[model samples]
Target: MAKIWVFAEVNNGKVDTAALEILTKARELGGEVEAVALGPGSTDAAKELGQYGATTVYASDDEVYADYVAQPAAHALHELVKEHAPELILFATNYDSRDIAGRLSARTGSTLMSNCFDILGTDKARTTIFGGATVVDVALEGTPKIALVRPKSFEPEASGGEANVMPVEVDIPDDLKKAKRVERHEEQASGPKLEEAPIVISGGRGLQDASNFELLDQLAGAIGNAAVGATRAVVDAGWVPYAYQIGQTGTTVKPGVYIAFGISGATQHIVGMKGAKTIIAVNKDEDAPIFQIADLGIVGDALKILPQLIEEIKTRKG
Candidate 1:
C-alpha cells in the first residue's frame, strides 16, 4: 500500500480539528496513513490521532520546536521524509504548517499543492482559483507529493483504533534555529469559535452601524451555540476585530447553518463560506449576488428583521 503522512498540529495539548480532518480524508485513499506530531503537547496530540485513522505517529514532545520558529520543525521533518520516503505528505493550511510545507518542498524538490480542498486519491488534488469561481485539479507528480489542505473541507470521523506512538529525536543545527519565538499570545474570545460553530450568524454592510452588532450578539445568545462573524469590509472599517472576519483573507468557516445579514456576496467573501451546508441570506436588494447561492433568501432590511428573529428564538425557547 502507498504511504501517506500527515503533519498533526497540536493546540493546548490536543490535536487541532484541521489535522483530524486531513487524517480522516487520508485514510480513504487506501494508503497506510501515518502522522508526525511535534512541539509541546505533541505526545498527547499523537495519542488522539489513531482514532482519526493514523496508523502510526512520530511524536516529539521537545520544547525546541515550540521555542523556535518553523525552521527547526521543517529541518527535522525534512530528515524524516528523506529517511522514510513516504509517497505523500499532507499539511493543514495554518501558519506553521505553511512554513514547514514550503520549506520541505524546497528541500525535497517535490510537487507541492497549496490551498487544496479535496484530494482525488493519491495522484491528484483539487483547489480553487479566481477567488473560488473556478475549480482546478492538480496532478501530483514526483516521488513525495505535498499538499496543504484548507480547513473545513472534509468532515472528521473516528475509526476507533490506536496509533503506534513512535518517539523520535532530531538534533536541530545551530543555523536552522536562528529565528526564535520569544512569546506567544492567544486571542481572547468568548463563545464558540467561528470555524467550529454549528451555526454562524454574520453581518455585513447591511447592518448599517457597527453598534448594531449587538443585535447579532443577542441573536447568537438566543440561538445558543452560535458565533458571530463579519465580512472583510466591516473588519476593515473596524466594526469588529480581524479575528471575527470571514473571507478569503480571513477565517474560512463551514458551519451547518450560515446566516448572512446584508452581505452582497463578494467573490472573496463567498470563497470562504460557500462550504457551509446551508446558507440563509437577508438583504434589501433582491438582486444581490448572495441570493444566487443562498438556500433561503429574504428581501428586507437585515437590521429591522434581526430584532424580530431574536425575539422569536427567545419565545420559542421560553
Candidate 2:
C-alpha cells in the first residue's frame, strides 16, 4: 500500500484551497493521506488539513518556517517523507509549488509529474496529461512518485468527521537554513479570485484604451460574482494587473461562463480558457478568431455592447 503525502500550504494562518483539492484526490486514490504544513504558527493550519481527509498532519512550527520561501518548506517536507516513506507526494501547481516540487524531486530522485489535470490508474501505475491536452501515462521507476496537481481540476471532498493532527519534529537541513526570507511583500486587491469565480469577463486589444476597463467592471458587477480578466496585450498595455491576465503565458481559468469583450482569441489565450463551460465573445470583427470557439458572439463595439448587456442583466435581476 502506498501512503500519499500532500503539501498543505498556509499563508498568514489561512489555508489555501489547493491543499484541500489535493487531499480530496488523495483519498480517491485509496492511499493513506498525510499532509505536511511548514510555518511559524502551523498547528492551526495542520488541523484544518484534517477536515479535508488528511489522516496525519505534520506541523513544523519554527522561526525558519516563518517565511513563505519554497526552499525551507521543501526541506521540511523532504524530512517528513524520509521518516514516513510515502509512496506518492502531491502539490498544488502554483509558482511556489513548482519551485518546491522541483527541489524535492532532485533531492529524492523521484519522478515528477507537473500540472496534471487528471490521474488515471491501471493496476500498474498512475497517468496524467498537461495543457488540458496530450495524455501521458507514467509508471514510477522509483519507490515514491510525485505529482503537482492543477487547482480547480477536482472538487474538494469534506471529511465527514474530525481529522487527526500530529506534530512532527525534524532538523532543518543546513542547505535550506542558509536561505532566509528577509522581506515579504504582497499585492492587495479586493475581488473574487479569477480561478475560483463562476463568471469571468475579459478584454483584449479591441478595447483600445486602458480607461475603458471600467466597462468591464460594470458588466462584471452586474453578473454578480463575476471576475475581471484580461488578455496579454491588455496586460502588457497596463490595462490590468498581471494576475488578471489569462492566456498561455498567464493564468488558466475554467469558469462556468467566460465572456470575452473585444478579444481576438489568439491560440495562446484560447488554450488557457478552452476549458470554460460557456464562451461568449463581443467584437466588431466577425472574423475575429474568438468567434470560432465562442458559444455566442455579438458583432459590435464592446464599449457599447457591454453597457447594454449590463443594463439587461440588471433589469432581469430586478
Candidate 3:
C-alpha cells in the first residue's frame, strides 16, 4: 500500500474542492492516507477532510501561517515529512499550493513532478509537454515524491468517515512572518467557478471589442449554468481581465461542454482547454485551427450567430 500525505487547502473556513478531489483519489490509490491542513482556516475544515477519506488530519490553525506566502506552511510541511516520512505528498496545482510545493521541494531537496493529469503507477505520473501536444509518463526518484495535480482532473467524492484531527503547532521564523496581509478583494462571481463549471463559453479578439462580451454573458444566461471565459489575446488587449483568460498563461479548464467563439485555437489557448469533454467552435474562418479539435465546427460569424443562439436556447427552455 502506498503512503500518501495530501495537503488539504481550505478557503473561507471550508475544505476546497480541489483538496477533496485529491483526498478521494488518495483513498482510491489504496494507501495510508493522511491530510495536512494548515493555516487558520484548516481548523474548521479538518472534519470535512475526514469525510473524504483523510484517516488522520494534521491540523495547524496558526494565524501567522493563514496567509499563503509559501514560507511558513512549507516549513511546517518539511518538518512533517522528515518525521513521518510518507512515501508521497500531493498538492493541488492552484496558485498558493504551487508556491508552497516549490518551496517545500527546495527545502526537502526533492524534484517536484508537477501538473500531473493522472497517477499511472506507484511513483509514475503523467503530465503534458510541448504546449500540451504530448503526454509523457515519468517516474519520480526521490524518497518522498512530491506531485502537483492539475485542477478539474478528477471529481470530488464524499465518503463520510470521521478523521482523527490532531492539532499541531508549526514555528514560524521571524523572517517568514515579516510580511502581513493588508487587504483582499474577492472576485465577483455569479455562477460556478470557472474550473468547476460544467459548461464554458470562451470568446476571443474576433468579438471586436470588450462591449461585445455582453453577448457571451447573455448566452451564458441562456445556458443557465455556463461560465464565460476569454483567450489570452483578448485579456492582454484589455478586453477582459486576466482571471477570465483560458490558455497556457491563464487558467486550465476541463468543462464538460466547451464552446469557443471567434477563437483561432492557438496552441497556448488549446493547452488549457483541450481536456474538455465536448468542444464546439464558431468562427468565420472555416479553416481555423480550433475546428480541428471541435466536435461541432460552425463556420459562421460568432457575432451574428451568438445572438440567435441565445434566443434559441431561451425559447427552447421557456
Candidate 4:
C-alpha cells in the first residue's frame, strides 16, 4: 500500500470543506491516508478529519502558523517529509495552501502539480489546460509528489472513525518569521458562502451597471439560501468586490443550481462554473456560447427580466 498525506486546513473551528473533499479522495486511492493540520483550532479539528477518512493526524496548535505567514509551516512540513516519507502530499487550492505548497516545493525539490481535479492512480493527476477546454493528465514524479486540488472536485464522505492525533515538533529560526500578521479583516456575509452554496446567482456585464446587482441581491434574498456571484468583467469594472468574482483568476463554484444573468460565458468564466450540476443562462443574444452548455437558456434582456422574476418568486413564496 502507498502512503499519502493531506494538508488539512481549518476555518471557523472546523476542517475546511475542500480539505475534507481531498481527504475523501485520498482515501479512495488505496493508501494509508494521513493529514497535517496547523493553526489554533487544528487539534480540535482532528476528530472531524478522521471522520473524513484520515487514519492519522499530525496536529500543531503552535501560534507561529497563525501569527506569521507560510515560511514556518513550510519548514515544519519539510522536516516532516524527511522523517515520514509520504509517497504523495495533497493540498487544497486556496490562498494559504498555495503559499505553503510553493515554499515547500522550493525546499523539497518536488514536482508540484496544481489545479488538479482528479488523482489517477499513484503517479498521475488530471487537470484542465487552455482555459479548461483541454483535459490532460500530469505525471506526479519525484519523491513526495505534491498536488493542489481544485475545490468541489470530489464529494466528501465520513468513515465513522477517529484518527490518532500526534503533535508536530519543529524549531523555527528568527529569519523565517520576518513577515508577521498584524491584523485580519473578513467580509460580513449572510447565508451560505459562494463556493459552498447550493444555489448561486451570478451577474455579468449584461447587467449594464453596478446598481443592477441589487436585482441579484433581491433574487438571492427571495431564494432564502442562495449566494450571489459576479463575473470577472463586472468585478474589474468596480461593480462588486473581488470575493464575488468567479472565473479562472477568481473563485470556482459548483453549486447545485447556477443561474447566470447576462454572462456571455467566456471560457475563462466557464472553467469555474462548468462543473455545476445544472446551469441556467439568461442573455438577449440567442447565439451566446453560454447557451451551448446551459440546461435552460433564456433569450432576453436580463435587466428587464430580473424585476418580473423577483416579483414572481416573491408571490410564489407568499
Candidate 5:
C-alpha cells in the first residue's frame, strides 16, 4: 500500500481551502494520509487538517519556518518526504505549492504533475492533465511521485476523528538558508477572495478605461456576495490587481454564477472559468467569443447595461 502525503498550508492561523481539498482527495486514494505543516507552532493547523481525513499530522514549529518563504519550507517538506517515503506527495497549485512541487520533484527524482483538475484512479499510476486537458496517466518511474492539484477542483470533505499529531525536526540545508526573505507584504483585505466568492463579475478591455471599473465595483456590491475579476487584457492595462485576473496566467475560478461583462472571452480566459456552474456574458460585440461558452449573453454596452442590471438585481433581492 502506498502512503499519501498532503502538504497543508497555513497562513495567519487559518488553513487554506486548497490544503483541505488535497486531503479529501488523499482519502479517496486510501492508505495512511499524513498532512505535513511547517511553520511557527502550526499544531492547531495540523489538528484542523485531521478533520479533513489526515490520519497523521506532522508539524514543525521553528522560527525559520515562520516566514512563508519557499526555500526553507520546501526543504522542510523534502526532509519529511525522505523520512516517510510516501508514494505520492500532493500540494495545492498555488504559487508556493508550484515552487515547492518543482523543488521536491528535482530533489527526489520523481514525476511531477502540476495544475491537475482531477486524479483519476491509480492503477498503472496517477493520472492528471494540464487545465483538465490532455490526459497523461503516469506511473511513478521513481519511488515518490509529486502532484500539484488545483484549488476548488475537489470539494473538501468533513474531517473525521482526531488527527495523530507528531513533531518533526528538519535541518535546513545551507544552500536553502542562503536564500532569505528580506520583507513580507500583504494585500489589503478585499471584500472576499475571488475564488471563494459565490458570484463573480469580470471585466475585459471592452469596458473602455480604468474609470469604467467603478461600474464593476458597483455591480459586485449590488450582488452582495459578488467579487470582482478582470480578463487578461484589462489586467495588463493596470486596471486591477493581478490576483483578480482570471485566465491561464491568472486565477482559475469556479463560482456558482459568473458574469463576464465586456469580456470578449479569449480561449485562455475561457479555459480558466469554463467550470463555472452558470455563465452570463455581456459584451457589445455580437460576435464575441465569450458568447459561445456563456449560458446567457447580452449584446449591448456594459456601461449602459450594468447600471440597469444592478437596479434589477436590487429590486429582485428587495
Candidate 6:
C-alpha cells in the first residue's frame, strides 16, 4: 500500500480547513494517510487530523518550528520524507505550505503541482487554467511527489478516530533563523472570515468609494453570518484590504449565497466566485456582464435599494 503524508497547518490551536479537506480526500484514495502537524498548536491539530482520517500524526512543535523558521520547517519535512519515503505529499495553498512545498520539491527533485482543486488516482491531480475557463490534468512522475491543494476546494469531515501521535524533532542550522520577526500587525477583523463564510456580500467600483463599503457592512450585519467582500478594482483602489478581495488574482470562493453590488462581473472577477451556489447581482446597467451568471439580476441603483432592503429585513425579523 502506498503511504500518503499530509502536512497540516495549525491556526490558533485548530487545524486549518484546507488541511482537513485534503485529509478527507486522502482517505478516499485507499492508503495509509499520515499527517504532520506543526507550530504552537501541533498537539490539538494532530487530534483534529486524526478525526479527519489521518492514522499516524507526526507532530513537530519544537522551538525551531514553533518560532516560525520557514527554512527549518522545510528542512525537517525533507528529513521526514527521506526517512518515510511516502509516495505522495500534500500541502495547503497557504503561505507557509507553499514555501515549504517549493523548497521540498527542489530538495526531493520531485515536481510540485500547485493550485489543484482535486486529486485523481494517486499521482495525478486536477487544476484549472485560462482563468478557470479550462480544466487541466497533471500527473507527477517519481516518488514523494508534492501537491498544494487550494483552500475550500474539498469538504472537511471527521471520522471519529484517534491518531497515533509521534513526536518529531530536528536540528535547526544556525544560519536558517537569520531573519527574526520584529512585529506583527493585524487588522481588526469582524464576523466570519470571507473564505469560510457561507454568505458573502461583495462590492465593486460601483460602490463609488471606500466609505460606500459601509452599505455592505450594514447589510452584512443585518443578514447574519455574512462576510463582506470586495472586487479587485475596489481592493486596488484601497477601498478594502487585499484579504477581502474575491477575483481571479484573489480568493476563490464557493459560498452558498453570493450577492454582488455594483460589480460588472468582468471575466477576471467571475473566475473567483463562479462556483457560488446562488449569485445575485445589482447593477444600474441591465446589460452588465454580471447579469449573465446571476440567478437574480436587479437593474437598479444599489444605494437606494439597500437601505429599504435592510429596513425590511429588520422589520420582518422583528
lDDT of 1 by residue, 1-318 (tens): 899999998866878899999999999998999999998898777768998999899999988888888898988898899789899999998888998899999899988999899999787999999878889998989979999999888889998879998887899888887888887777757999999899999999999899999999999999999999999999999999888889877789999999999999998899899988999999999999999999999999998899999999889999
Which candidate number maximizes TM-score?
4
Summarize candidate 2's per-residue lDDT along 153-233 as a digit string, tens digits.
678888854557777676766766665678766674467888878899999999989998999898888888989999998
TM agreement with the true structure for every prediction: 0.93, 0.87, 0.93, 0.96, 0.91, 0.93
Q: What overall lDDT goes with each candidate model?
A: 0.91, 0.79, 0.87, 0.91, 0.81, 0.87
Displacement of residue 120 (Cα, Å) in model 2 is: 2.1
Ranking by lDDT: 4, 1, 6, 3, 5, 2
Each model's RMSD to truth, in Å? 1.9, 2.8, 1.8, 1.4, 2.3, 1.9
Scored by lDDT, model 5 comes in at: 0.81
Judging by lDDT, tell me the better candidate of 3 and 5.
3
lDDT tens readout by residue for model 5, 1-318 = 778888887777889899998788878877688888878657888878989998889987776776536788878777888778888788888877787788878888888876666765432333334434566655545668777777778899876757999887777766766656677676844787888888889999988998888998998898888889998888888998788889776788899999998999887787678889999999999999889889999999998998998899889999
Error of 5 at 90 (Å): 0.6
Which residue pairs collide in model 4, if any? none
Query: What are the per-residue Cα lDDT tens digits for candidate 3 across 1-318?
Result: 668989988766877788888888888888898999888778678888999999889998887676647788888899998888888899988878888899888888887898897876558789989777798999988778899888667788999998898887667778886556667776757897787789999999789999999999999988978999999999999998788988776788899999999999999999889989999999999989999999999999999999999999989999
Model 4 reaches what TM-score against the true structure? 0.96
When 4 and 6 are scored with lDDT, the better candidate is 4
Runs off by more than 4 Å, candidate 2: 66-68, 122-133, 173-183, 247-250, 285-287, 315-318
lDDT of 4 by residue, 1-318 (tens): 788999988766778899999988998998999999988899999999999988899999888997889999999999999999999999988889999999999989999999999998677999999778799998878888999999889989888768999999888888999889998886748789999899999999999999999999999999879999999999999999989989886889999999999999998899899989999999999998899999999999999899999999999999
Query: Positional deviation of 60 in candidate 3, in angstroms?
Result: 1.3
Q: State the local distance difference test value for candidate 4.
A: 0.91
Better-scoring candidate (lDDT), 1 or 3: 1
User: Model 6: per-residue lDDT, tens digit, 175-198?
Assistant: 877655555565647899888789
Q: What TM value does model 6 have? A: 0.93
Candidate 2: C-alpha RMSD after superposition: 2.8
Off by over 4 Å in 1: none
